[model samples]
Target: MKSWTLTAKLYVSGLTFLVLALTSIGTTLWVTWNLEGGAAAVNEAGRMRMQTYRLALAASTSGPSGETLALIRSFDASVALLRSGDPSRPLFVPWSEDSRQRFRQIAETWRQLRAQWTADRPTAQDAARDAGRFVALIDGFVAAIEAQMSRSTTLLQGVQLAMMGLAIAGVVAMLYAGYLFVLNPLARLKRGLTSVQRGDLSTRVEVDTLDEFGQLSAGFNEMAQTLQSLYGSLEDKVREKTARLEVKRQRLADLYEASAFLAKAPSLDALARGFAVQVRRIAKADAAAVRWSDEGNQRYLLLAADGLPAALLQSEACLDTGMCLCGQRRAEASIRTIPIVPDPAVSMGNCQRAGFRTLISVPVKLHDRVLGEVDLFFREPVALDDEDRDLLDTLATHLASAMESLRAAALERETAVAQERALLAQELHDSIAQSLAFLKIQVQLLRDAMRREDAAAMNGIIGELEAGVRESYADVRELLVHFRTRTNEEDIEPALRTTLSKFEHQTGMKVRLEIEGHGVPLAPDVQVQVLHIIQEALSNVRKHAGAREVVLRVSRTPHWRFEVRDDGLGFDAAVGHADETHVGLRIMQERAQRIAAVVRVDSSPGRGCAVTLDLPAAAALEPAAPALGALA
Candidate 1:
């Protein structure tokens, strides 16, 4: 390519300016010659003819009427040049010869009229009357001619001045064009070329013209363009390398996030799931799966996976571990292969057939032992790079550590549960079993005393036997319900109602049982405890109070509320404590406490007694379950 300098283009533009200046000067001279000569001739003719016509009119005015009229008309013919009138209308300005001749006739007639009036006026008195009218008419004609002459003079002067101005403007425009198109463009090109020569290959020239100058400018532009393109390509390569570095940095960041997540995972399943999720995001894989060795088995179990078919994940021998498979095939395998199902809706490659395709299974090896393997797949086959393999290996190590800790925790929880069950067994045998045995012995003693009939001896024995029997009964009932040898499963409401009704049947006392809401299922231990409480309350009513009717109302919300009201000879409950006679009351209070319920008694000397029990519904249903109470 050729280069153009500022001096070469500026010299060409200077010649172009000189030619334009000369042409403008020649044009101005030609226009001046035509306008000045033509306008002068017209003005001279108008002046001469106007003076001649005025003199001729004056000369004919003093002759005889007919002869004077003839003289006025003949000499006034110069007024035939008075062409246009009413100048504002389109056809009013009479420029044609025929129209001018018609106007001459009008001027001639005016002159003849003046000659006749002058001839008829033989005296000064008559002449004076018409003189004023004749003078006024002549004055109007002269004024009209003068005004037309002035307009012609102004128009010619304007034309001459416009020609000169145009010539000057043309010269100035040529000089400006030389600077804008040639000089400025060349100057820019010179600086740009210098920059390019100094190793700034990105510099470029700006040229927009259409002559020889423009052609040279275009050549310089092309040269700069070639250098710019060469350098731009090199810069693009650097940017590509920088972008790859950024991608590697992002991968390192993802690894740290995965490490933090693994540290917090509490179980083997959670750790495996977290590893698979991170792998899915980093690789942009369609699905990810993890398989680990089961604790006591040689076979691999699928621990976790995303977007894998449930049937294939659960099926035996679905994934291959690289070592055994590589040995069998006589190949040094880096990753094992399996069919991984991609979600049809989410997979980008929807044009392919619907099913599993290729999978890349990389083993998670911790030290010398193979803990598990991770499988990643795409809708289309993906070729793994060395970086991908290494990153996966790091993730696998972290996941293995997390899984080992989780396994140890599971074993610890199992041991704790076993110890708790053992302690519960010991408590039930030591306390409840012994109390039930003592109750059975005392019941036999009471029966034996009743059989041997001796009057005073019988009376004292009956009192002793009744007190002993009451105490033994309270102990035995509490043991069976709360500290049970063998727990029984019974619904809470039916058991409670049946126990109260049985006491009424035994003593021939009227008892009313009312239940509200619907019956719910209860655990056996909870039901037994609640039933014994009701039994104890009823026994207290029979033993101490000489009341007739009793009402047992059972209400259930999220918890149970049992109320036992007896119309018995009530005692002041606050001032007294449970003795051998009131041992049943003490048993009822103890049973309510064991079940995490509240028991209150309302009694007075002359009023009836009402015992109320409010237990959490879960406690009234299951001994071990946590209670969900009502909102209020």
Candidate 2:
């Protein structure tokens, strides 16, 4: 039955075969047991014939003797064996009407024979007659037992043949049942599994029975259906993911291009225009506008825009913060989406009148400060998602970084110009200003000498005035050359040679430049400071040292070292340590400090002055990199 599982079906079929096999075995055993008893009974019947002959002999030989008595008792036992079964010996007739009658004849004949043999002196004639009758009865009993045993043998053989037939029939039935219940279903299930393995989700197993395998087939079909349903939508899911990936890839490329362009942009306006173009292309908007706010965050100027009407760009070129949607102050960093609505009451609402329906304003911010904003306008309404908002914000960020960089550079340039002007004023005070003061004093002396009419004093005063004029002229030329010169970062030898040659030509003094062990060259800024210090030493030599010959010694390793020695009228180092008297010594010390170098002056009242510059070994290993041309 369909309700019966495989276990129940097999159990019932197996039980039927077991019952038949047991019945056959039990029937054969029963027949064999009956034949065993009949065989024993037949054997005892045959032994009674021998006892009959022995008894006749005993009767004729001696009457009432011990031997004759024993023969008689033996005969009695044989009869008793046929009458009652010897269970231990298994000696019994197969009880039937013919077997019982035959057994009774054997017992009656034996009793008569025993009585005749036991006579007081029995004659041979009587004994022979009794033995013959007794022997006939024993033969009849054995024949009946043989017939019953033959019947038992035939019945046992029949039971064996019936069992064999039952076994053959059972085999045929089980083969059919197994094929119907197990093999056929399994073969179908296997085919279905193969199809599924080959990627056919449509393959299904048909369930014809409510067995375990049938439940398995039903479950398999359900699984295949689910797979088919899921696979139907798999292509759409893949396409969706691929489209999203494309958007992300495009976003990355745009960000990379914008960052590179902004990083190296020459000016703020240039950076803003380039970034605005990039945003317009990426967002596919109608018009893009970029603005930069002043430091006060109060007023902002429209820096650049890619696609905007000339009229609109001019009108919105400059606006105050909080005036329009694009220029509104921001509390948090986020993209603002505005729907432009034309309203006559609104004073600064020019977007809707310009045929723009949507306005997306993204603020350009650096960390916490809002620098400005970028506005995108669309004639048709536009929808912006989180990704679109993030992209606009990132573009704004790049713009902010570029603007900050340009502003910082401008400020640096102005600061440098102011510092150089201050240096010039100091140079004038140290050289030209002091020289004119000397000229004024000498003119005063010359007038006094002329009033006195003393020839000797007038001649001396004129000569002194002539020398002062030459010194003033020389000081002006040296000051001009010092401020105009530039330093080379790669090597200092060329600049040193040029400075020494100029010093020799201007002072009309023999100059010797001695260079020592060299290593990696000094940076341009360091070279600038070193050159300034060296020139200051030369100025001191020309003004006061009165040296005819000068030696500039330079050493680069194991540390940077320099010495400016002059064979002039040297002053006391202790007394002339004042910056005003030593001619820009304080300026030289300041320049030395900038490069981490030490400047020491060695001199006596008669000996020449030598300015020594020493840079420590540790500082010379790796030069610092704060702009090579940033010395000013």
Candidate 3:
């Protein structure tokens, strides 16, 4: 077990010893004082009884043969009875056996005299003298006992007061000694420890004694000095390492950001601009420029530059062809300096612009094919390091990769678009075209009946033509809507609103919608599935139920719930299940199941239908507007 702290041990030891000493002394004094008090009380009671007996005898001597004699006899008998009372009761005593015998003899003599006086009237001169002597003797004995008890009480009180004074003095001395030895030292130690804990390594406790506490303070001070030295050395090492790492990390981040931009650039001009920005940040250059290689190193074309005037960037002839061109002709791993002289033809004869001097162009090559050259210019001549040339080479390599990937992605998107167009073409030919052909045939038959001049045949043909036209239009419109929708990129809410609004507008029914909760965008595939499910539901309601008023509620809780209620004639959904009249209802159920959504249809023969669809919130999304293809 860990040893207790010195302060705790000292406190416990001092308090325990002090308590024991005080308790023992206090108990002894209390017991002695109370015992003495009990003895004194008994002595005083006995002395009072003896004094009363003496007074009774004296009264008896004064009255020889009267009622006073009888009174004296009664008093003497009462005292005798008290002396011979229960053994459990205390009796007064002298330390001598002779004094006890004398008290008993006096009691006997008083009893004989009381008996004679009570029997008859008597006069006795000698008896009165003897009784007076007995009374005086008893008075003296009572007085002596009282005096002894008073003295004993005074001595006991004096001893108790002295013991109390000693106890108080001892407690005060202990407290004073503890304050000087324990508490003051402890307070100093605590303040010193707090200062050290707060990082003040120079703070040290004053050594007042050759003890363990002084040793502890010295050890703490030594530990603080060690920590401060170690911290200084570690910080210096970390700063040196961090500075080196930061430069390399910045270079890498700049390369990646430039590569990302080049990959997405629409044209070569965008790529050149992005490369200029990245190189300026990486090189920490005052001015930078990119010069693309012409065919067969015939000429160098200035593509982009940073910290240069817009006029110089736009004008190709502004750069010195001699200096800018030499970078392409230089050795692959060589760095060359060229002097830039402002061309009078392109510089526009501005006196302020011609003052810049010294150009260093680094040639950019990818797999031995020279792509371009990056040129830097400074006001004063500066030497270029191998690391600087290496960075330029790395940036050129990344640009090449970005350009190649961009070409590949463009080709892939084109191929995918071609395949999707072909599929849509076939669907339209199979569904919509055939429906239109059949409607045309029905129209021709109606026209033929009109030429025959038969009224009943004409009327029947006209009725068939009208029915075919209506059916063909409904089928073609539905097919066209389905074909135009791009399921992979469709949104949910717009599709729902479009479908519900179409129903209300076409059927002239009062339809209201209430939407709630935070609507979030979802993946395109999930948006399509939910939109189709909503369309199917409302289509069934419009076809079967003659609903005048319909309410569409789209809300999101932990999950999305789409509820469509209609106040119209309804049929048993169970009966509709057995019968296949409502194929739309079956389609709705299948679509909801495919999306892992719940569908509830409540209806009776006379009541309305309430169709509720709940889908996962993660799968619910807002609808997208129809694209140009959809409009077509």
Candidate 3 least-lDDT 10 residues: 623-632
Model 2 C-alpha RMSD vs. true structure (Å) is: 5.5
- Give all candidates' CA lDDT scores: 0.60, 0.82, 0.63
Question: Model 3: per-residue lDDT, tens digit, 18-45?
Answer: 7866765676665455445435444544
RMSD after CA superposition, every candidate:
19.6, 5.5, 21.2
Among all candidates shown, the one with the greatest lDDT? 2
Candidate 3: the clashing residue pairs are 491-623, 491-624, 492-622, 492-623, 493-623
| Per-residue error (Å), model 1, residue 253 | 35
Quote the positional error of residue 372 for candidate 3 in Å: 13
- List runs of model 1 lying over 4 Å from the truth: 1-499, 502-508, 514-535, 539-548, 553-562, 567-572, 575-597, 603-608, 614-632
Off by over 4 Å in 2: 1-240, 294-301, 309-324, 342-348, 443-466, 484-488, 491-523, 541-558, 565-571, 577-581, 604-609, 617-629
Best model per TM-score: 2
TM-score, every prediction: 0.33, 0.74, 0.36
Instruction: Give the range where candidate 2 is weakest over 10 consecutive residues by summed lDDT.
Output: 623-632
Model 1: per-residue Cα lDDT over 1-632, one tens digit each: 12444455556656765675566556555444433433443453345345444434443455355654554455444344334222222112213343344345446655565555545533444444444444444454444434544554565566557657756775777677667765776788789778978988767665555656666667877877776786779788889999999989988999889988988987676787778888888878877877776433244667778776555455533334333321111123246554434455433232124253666767666555666667676677666678877887777778777777677667666665664455345434443454455556655665676676445665665676576566556544544443332233345555555566567766788988888876566556556556666766776776678889999998876567889999888888777664533455665676677677888888998898999988876764466332211000
